[model samples]
Target: MTALPPVVDEQTWRDALADLLVREKAATKELDAIAAARRRLPAVKLPEYRLTAEDGSSVTLAEVFDGRSQLVIYHHMWSDGNRWQCSGCTGLTSQWTRTGALAELDARFVVVTNGPMDEILAYKKRVGNEMTWYSSAGSAFGADMDAGPGEGFAFNVFLRDGDDVYRTWHTTSRGAEQFSLFFAISDVLPYGRQEVWQDVPDGWPQDPTYERWLTSKDVAALYGDPEA
Candidate 1:
């Protein structure tokens, strides 16, 4: 039988791991370049539509941008009646950071959904997100963006010049695998709490999935006890 190679010492093992990480970083840079290229492509024009804000205020697509040159609408998966407060949409929102500097870039980001303004407000409050949210409760905007029921996950960007709005780009991928600050940190840290029930080191409890984290009314009650 052939003999196996000798086991490496701790120092050698650490050096090998560091080399692998360097290569991974280089590969990640390539991925970022590709995403940048996609962003640089021309925008596509979407039809005009109206949506409602949480305060019951109605606004058209042009109005939503507040006269900005670009608009990014996250077609949240909230639907009328029974399908309100979609988990996937909630997950995406949870990962978003408020773009306070968006105005400087001539861009506005908003969440569009089929749920009523009240429902959207409730979900936003529950998730503690401060980003602007709106509802397309009575409109086909969601469907037009391919975010309607039974439609695949997607997000689209639009650019406005004069009175014309054009579609810029869109994307949909496995939620958990998407490269965000959360995932980047999780990939390096020994414990990255994502998608509740993710396994952790011994003595650490599995984190609750994002779905349960958002919908569970007793979340505070269950995890609230500081002494526990």
Candidate 2:
């Protein structure tokens, strides 16, 4: 091959890199605007529903917030019987950080699910996440939000002004993308970036392809002792 051209001067290289950084910042701003527009869309009204808590206490949707106008509900994908926990949910939950900023915005975040109170508590404790979690066992709230079993992952936001409650936003695809913030901030090495098809250094192991972890069990397993 012909000899390569002379290397560019440091100042020239820095100028070109600066220009690219400006463009990247502008692109990020545009993406943020798009996300803001999505959040501004109107929300459907949700009927008031009651759900049980992990403490064996009962709470209404509004009560979960401790008297706040907004709520961010994470439908944790936990199941009973042979289905002890959801890998995808576990993956997302493991990435959550309890930022006091959430409360400053007049909103509270919670993970609601049909899993038993004891099981949910055990998992939360094991994971070491401080985000509030609740059990929606025997409640229609989960079904109403399309977050029950057989339903895909969902992140939903609700706002209440007085007694009126409306769903402000909901997302299901690549919803766990925010988990990358940890790596972007250099807090932790990226783990599942492979899910985005991004290139990795040669010889690195690829991320697992399974959507959720499955427990070893047959169809008859559901009717037997659930905790066994």
Once fitted onto the true fold, the runs of candidate 1 whose alpha carbons sit more than 4 angstroms away are 1-14, 82-84, 150-153, 175-180, 191-228
What range of 10 consecutive residues in model 1 has the weakest lDDT sum?
219-228
Estimate candidate 1's RMSD in Å. 6.8
Listed per model in order, the count of residue pairs whose N, CA or C atoms clash below 3 Å is 9, 0
Could you tell me every candidate's TM-score relative to the true structure? 0.72, 0.74
* lDDT of predicted model 1: 0.67
lDDT of 1 at 194: 41
Best by TM-score: 2
- Per-residue alpha-carbon lDDT of model 1 for 1-228, expressed as tens digits? 432334799999889889999999999999899889977896667788888977798877777888899887777665555423455556556667668688899999877776788766665655555578878777888778777754655677888877677888776665424525556666575445544456544554344465334342332133222122
Per-residue C-alpha lDDT of model 2 across residues 1-228, encoded as one tens digit per residue: 322334799999899879989989998899899899987797898788887776679877778877889888888876675234665665565556655588788988888887778777765655554667888778877777878865766788899877678888877767645543533553233333343254554544455654223232221132223333
